[model samples]
Target chain A: MKQVVVHPERCVGCMQCQVACAVAHSEAKQLVPAQFESPRPRPRIHVGAGPYNEGFPNRCRHCDPAPCLLACLPGAITRVAETATVMINVDTCINCASCAMACPFGVIRYHEDRSAQAGKTVAVKCDNCLARQREDGIPACVEACLSAALTFETLDAAYKRQTDAVARSVSAVAAAEALAPGWALLNAHKKARLELLTSPAPSDEKRAAGNAREDTHVRHD
Target chain B: MQYVIIGNGIAGVNAAEAIRRMDPNGRIVMIGDEAFPPYCRPMISMVLEGSVPLAKLPIRQASFYDDCKIEPILGNRVTELDVDAGRVDVNGKHVAYDKLLIASGADPRPIRAEGLELGNIVYMRTEAHVRRMLDALDGGARRALVLGGGLVGFKAAYGLMCRGLAVTMLIRSGYPLSMQVDAFAGGMILDTLTAHGLDVRVDIAAEVFEGKDTVEAARLSDGSRLDCDLVVIGKGVLPALDFVPRDRIEVDLGLVVDPFLQTSAPNVFAAGDAAESIDVARQARWVNAIWPEAAAQGKVAGINMAGRTVPYERSLSRNVIRIFDLDVMTAGVVDPQVITGAEVITRFDPATRHYRQLVFQEDRLVGMTLVNAIEQGGVLMALIQNRIPVAGRRERLLAPGFNYRALA
Candidate 1:
């Protein structure tokens, strides 16, 4: 199944995805009119300013054996196997922050949502855009992402593409045949500027090991 | 392989499900005192508050045991345990098992007060107890007196007020939720409750109760008499490990368990409120009896019992309470004043009505208490639980708009 895969390196700190998400979930599926809707349709996807002042889009992973699902107080959270989506029953939710305490990624938010009964507040998070998928439309965030930071693809296909990029980046004709060369160069410059400003070496060291965008820059020194 | 699990709580239920997933052909026997379908224990307070209906409590159906193909024994607690023989005696029945799980959760800690054997006085712990309280409430319980300022007491007080009952709460501590939140946060919660019609008495205990059949009044420690018809005890809980032979098994406040959730006895394991695991934040053996911990511990324990070696690590004490207009979340050591070299950073935005208190041991976040704007509490708590060092300007964590990008 095609799911929204985030490529953070490709993000240019543009919050267009946030605007698109709010509109998609709004009673009126348009930007200008969604602003006027009661309760003001909020975006499920949150884009934060990254460590290097880049864009880091944060959304629910829809983790199997989801921590939020298990930590739910009223048993309001459940896993829908078809979309691999973890959903919250707004009616059953007691508005207790039990799910908030258990969510390690801090993706869940609480507020008065349109789906909640009688303007009641509920715990809200990414639902994999199941409503859009049902209508044969891709997720609004992916559609609005002009930079291709967000894409709709299967996990296997994403892994295959990333794996190929890693192989090609280290090859004999590496620089000319790099994957997303513009994005790779942009993040590299951000990292360099950040290193000169900060004194600590440990966070950078940990980031170097965990970051996948560093495939092009293998600095042994 | 034969598996026997004690208690029908989340811990035991999850363990049974875990064991069945690994060893599908294993003979599983589940013994529980509550005959009702496996329900969410934490939502009992919601039921008391009248926010959640009684039907919404059960997490599973009546056919859960049959669906799992397990033997079910209900309405009975284990009378005794023969650890050496690997048998549990309940209602004169000897249930033998190769693998044993003591997931019997905690019970409400009893208090000593006169006229204890009266009607209308109850403890808010089990669904049955909550049902009894509901019966009193349905019986037109107008004036209610509550003891203790802990989670149980606070919830009961909140529930009664919602039901239009005049509630007078007595707390042994300076403020409510003393165990869960710090002085500042506790005061905020107390003020909210007070505004919502909760008559609170601090540093006081019920010395004596005077009533005919049902409790009518209580003499407090401060030499004052309080008149009330309904009474609820919100004192905290202690582990329900009565059947275990402490001489053979190493027992602290709760049953001592290894990283694998296995007890000292052969083929015996424990989880949930009954087991004490190492606290990731405090770096000590502590029983985090919350529902989330119990659920996590059960899965780990079941996997280990099913022959897979899964270590149960990173047990942290955490709680999030939603009071009227306030969302308070706390984790690990919120009170770090006594700890040497503890650096505390706090911020309160009067404009946004958000408050954040971050306690640090060096660069690593040891504890935190978030008042409002607590959406990112889990991210902050993960740093504490994993002992991850904070890299950026630490003050950024106290910001109302803090997110994962700040750490990047």
Candidate 2:
């Protein structure tokens, strides 16, 4: 099944994902207007600054083995048949706070008294803007990320990349301190901004580099 | 049988059309309290910027009613409803109906403070509200004290900003839209508003509206006074259910309705800002006062009223607005400390003032907030709704200009 995989090493944590998700659900059907109209503009995803989390934009992993799906009492959360992504059915959500309570990552939130459904509160969490994809073929958050930090992937490939990302993060901390002293010591917010300017560029393979060189015109003096 | 619908707003207009589509043989009569034709309620703010003329706000043409063979009685309101006898009193005349719809949408909450009813003071709901606001603008109302920082409050503030009026939003809450978005996003929004040169103060309630014959100023709860030529009260709308029996049908933000948009009483239907429809996401029955929800609910209510037995699907309590050229959108619940285990990820570009965040549990996306960079709003929205798995490509999902087909 496809799922969201984050490369925190590549993350500048620009927060485009959250705005994109909110806009995806916005009434104005666009971002700028949605931001203005949203009172408590429920953002499904959250971008936080912490020593433990660093610059990664957090979202549901959509596990092959799901915990939240099993915990939901009213069966509000479900796995889409096509994408194997876990989704919430607003119709089925009872807002019992069961699945929300059981969530290990604290993804599900109870939209208590502000909704139209009685005894049924909206659970605020990321469905990955699936509605947009079904119609437009691209998720809002995924398309909006500028640092190439957030991405979509299957389980096996994600695990490998995540493992590699952790490794890179560990080394990058050292490299970052060396390249720019006192940078690694900076807090999450400062680090995120610095990462925006200093993060390593996407590695180019040999074939791509060869293609780029061929495209470059030579100036003979 | 004659069917009477109250209100010429989105809900009432759509209800008329829905009734025509269902019960073509039945006589459809629409009663509106406003003089203007049915218009998009959300577009009212656009009028402040002169982006749309007062005449263009109507959702449909004048011939719409004529084509549908519907009789629309404008500039009249039904103050009394005789549900037992199935009749409504409008302009001293009783209109009979076999099935009556109480689509009398809520009016903007009026400021009870003294001197608030002056020519300058206005509630931004109808065309008249806009007309008064424009007149005041022409009268050189240099400053505006907007009461309440809710959707309407913010919209008015933005509109006033567009009009080059020094605007200050006074809210009783700790922050603007504290109930809808998280503190971080809210802070970002506050910053955006502040950056636009509007003064926004939260946790300071309006104790009283102080002015002479006309609105001149407002006194705050924090012992501060705001001097302005205009004052707007946008404390939200209360359902216009004065005619209905209080004990028979319960009302809490609005008229309580079942999943099918049916009222507590059998054969009686309710929709629009007046009815409490189910919030499919939050799974609670609360009154959603937005335009799209009202229109969609009205259509569903009409279909079901015609013996179609169609179920009303609650939409995600969604709102989107524009501040200058910046795009901002929010969805789902955003209460603080509500999320315990969910991993929060934020991407902020202070230089560009762009922010995007996604909240996830395990691997699935459940909520999001977007600001500035909103073109990909559809993509992330789909992922949240579809809960698309981001396992391998979670990193790619955050990449700028990622291939669309790859995600699919």
Candidate 3:
């Protein structure tokens, strides 16, 4: 059972996964055709700019004891036992954002979907690309990700690999393993630049005035 | 073990299911006032508004009791509960129990007025009441008069409005859902309802019903007579704990339950609308009678009843409502005046019509009211629930694009 794993540090917020996601869920299933499709397909995954302007990929964890499932008023949300995917029945969904309030990760979105009843809007979310998976394909988001930020692998395999890397990093005799050295360096540079620009004292009043709303807004593209 | 559970609501049903998972051989006898299978209680409002059919209310299948191997005593209310003797009297029969759960839920608080037995006047609490309202609608109900500023009354008024009826809501507060949300957020909700042509009368209530066999009009408290065909009272609900012996079992606003969801009496427990436990945000005794709380409490109660000492966590007061174009989510102590040292921050983006009002007691997020953009509400709610320190992160939460990463 391979599932999508998130590696936030490697993400550059290019939004290629968002484009690929919309195309994958669209009627024509292509980038150019998806734009012209009625009730345009939307991405289920979101990329949030972290506090220090680092890219952070956000999506549903498909929790075993999902809060959204329990808090659902119409009982529209359910879990697929095989894939461990939380699926929403759009027909039964009342367009009530109860699931959004229950979802701690803030993954679920409400919009008019093409697969749903014509013009009726409903709660839409990630289905783990079950249709694509059935055809022996990976999730659209993972396939579109160029930075290896999102990968498809078994949870145990991912955990074991991470554990081995962490153990080796702590060993005194062995050289530490930096998983994505280039990405790590890039993120550290961005964070340091952000810290320096915003931490100006009273003497730097001109810089402070320009950077007042610098940390206020960060678009989740 | 003979397990006697009261009420077939979500709480009782979840408790029964939990106990079945642990004790397969226990003789579970569930006594419920509602004869129908366990249905989502909150969806009764949807049923009222004609969005969801009455048939679609059941949360469980027809073979629920059979599958769980539990004996069900339906269409009966608990007449008396003898905690000392470990017995329950429902429909003139003493059903014994080794471990008892009082998940009897709550009933709509009755209002005092003339013509109390009027035919068309109803409380939108039970499925049967909604059925009665539907029948009235089918019988050519035109004008509706709703009382109360609470969720029930507000929902009833909204439901009637959705059905293309002329609705006049009489609220005894500054705005609707006053208890659930703050004044500013309440005003936003009130605006949406009004924009949809819902006639709202603030600080007003119905004094008397004037009609022959069915309600035709209501005499207002402000000395005004209004024409109405149906009357729905949503003045809120009281705990259905009349049967409990207060002398033996401690009772507050609801039945007082311990951390393990057990009552003061041994071998007895209470959950759902009837259980009063410590409130996480308020940090005091409070009854969060919502469905999700009931489900969580019942699971814990059943687990503890099955011989595992699983302590139930402090309950949070929360509600999320999607009314018209507005989505409102509120939790905990929303009223700032109630808390002496509480600091309140409100940010309204008029362009998008999104609002965020957060109440804080020192570094902890005590309560929150969100309008429109509320996808990340659960994150803020978790912060409040866990009593996490939000020293410099308060402004970040008020931002419209706030998400889980914002907290990090």
Candidate 4:
């Protein structure tokens, strides 16, 4: 399936991706015209400050077992089997924000649309630009990224790119090892780092452990 | 292999899907007592409110059964389970199976009040119940007396109110949703419901239903009578396990199942509201009757039945409901009675109708209740599931801007 991969290091924090996303979802589908629309177009992607000063655009990961999909009472949010894109049907949404609350990533946003529900609000989230993709195009965010920070590619291609990068790094390390006999420890560390970077990210176990602690601390008032 | 699943609800249907994925050529037979195809039960209230039509009730499309290649025997009830014989009697006909799953779900606990036998006394359980209630409402039934202040009861009352009926909710306890939320949150919910023109009476019980052929009035335990044309009994549900013999398969409030959802009987398994699985919060065996848990349990049972070794992960009790335009959610060990030795950090903004309470035992979050503001619920549940220690981060949990990544 095609997914938008984020390159935070390459991001300049321009926020053009957010603007483009909003415009893409707007009725006019243009920057200047969308701003004058009845209900202001809301961006599905959010450009937020990241750790280490590299700003990243956070959006829906479209998790297989999406919590938003499970929490939706109106059955508005659904995953299309063909595209594997999690889409929300705004017509059926009750604007309950159940999906918003259930999203662990806090990517789903509530947009007040006067056109839809007489100024009533509804849940909105990234659909991976499914409409544009049908025309063999990428998401608006990817298209708008001036720094090439976002790229839409298949999962296999993404993994291959990462593996190729790691292979090149390992080869560079091997060249260095030929010159220095004391680079064994550095090679092991590099391999470990590559493994961590390449593998599918696991759910944060440490944070979960912190939240599940069953001890008491006397509060100092 | 012949895989027979009783009750084509979420659990049975998901199990069938999972079984097909595992064993390609397995013969899957899904039996349901309901005439309609498997539908989302939670949306029944929306249907009653006229927000969602009955046509949109089915969870999957009409071609889903055919695509899955599973035989569906709808409107046929399973009468007996012959564990030793490896077969079940469905409406008197015995159907053999290599493995069996009992996901018959649950039925509304019968109200034993005096006037329950009268007409217009309804229990919200099946599509038929919604149809009956709708029919009565269409026949100009205006006043509604809804007994039980729980989730089902509240939904019934709210739905009735939406249909232009005057709804009066009678709660046996001191507050509504006492099982899910605390007294404080329940009071807020009551206020919201009342603001929407609902008559909520707490610390009250129906002494008797009084009428000639139909319920005309409900006599309260507090010496008051409520005149009503319709009565909706949302008094909770019990596991529908009458088909299985108690001696053959161990049964408590529900059928007892192992971690793999395997019952005491060989080749027989159980899932959904019908099975008493482990409560992940309490680390004890109990039935968490929520839909997600049912789906998870069903998937686990299906995989194991298909010769795949996968243990069922115990699920925490979690529920999200919209009551009178307010969103209320509770998860994990939120019941105050059982959540002893836990420190509670609460933040309530009555002005905004946003209330958040986090329950922590030592440094770990064990339970949480969010009213109006519930965006952090999924994060909280993940923390509970992962057993994350939040030692000094209790305050962050109730914060509106709290992010799970920050904890990481």
Per-candidate fnat, comma-separated: 0.52, 0.00, 0.48, 0.20
Against the native complex, each candidate's DockQ, computed on alpha carbons, is 0.31, 0.02, 0.42, 0.18
Task: Put down candidate 2 lDDT per residue, A1-221, tens digits, no spaces.
Answer: 45566655455557878887777777676766766763445667766433222454656667654656644433456787687678877765543344432344545555532223444446667776677667855667777877666776677987875576566667866445333223244434454654554446643221222111221221111
RMSD of candidate 1 to the truth, in angstroms, is 5.9
Stretches of candidate 2 off by over 4 Å are A1-221, B336-343, B360-366, B379-408
TM-score of 2: 0.62
Q: Model 4: what TM-score?
A: 0.85
- Considering only chain A, what is the TM-score of each predicted structure? 0.83, 0.64, 0.88, 0.73
Proportion of native contacts present in model 1: 0.52
The candidate maximizing DockQ is 3
* Number of backbone-clashing residue pairs for each candidate, in the order shown: 1, 140, 0, 19
Model 1 score (lDDT): 0.86
lDDT of 3 by residue, A110-203 (tens): 8899879998889888899999999999999999999999999999999998888878788765534546578978888877876688686755
Candidate achieving higher TM-score, 1 or 2? 1
Query: Which ranges in model 3 have alpha carbons more than 4 Å from their true place?
Result: A172-175, A201-221
After superposition on all C-alphas, the RMSD of every candidate to the true structure, in Å, is 5.9, 16.9, 3.1, 7.2
Q: State the fnat of candidate 4 relative to the true structure.
A: 0.20
Candidate 1 colliding pairs: A51-B408
lDDT of 1 by residue, A51-92 (tens): 566778888889887988888877789999989899999988
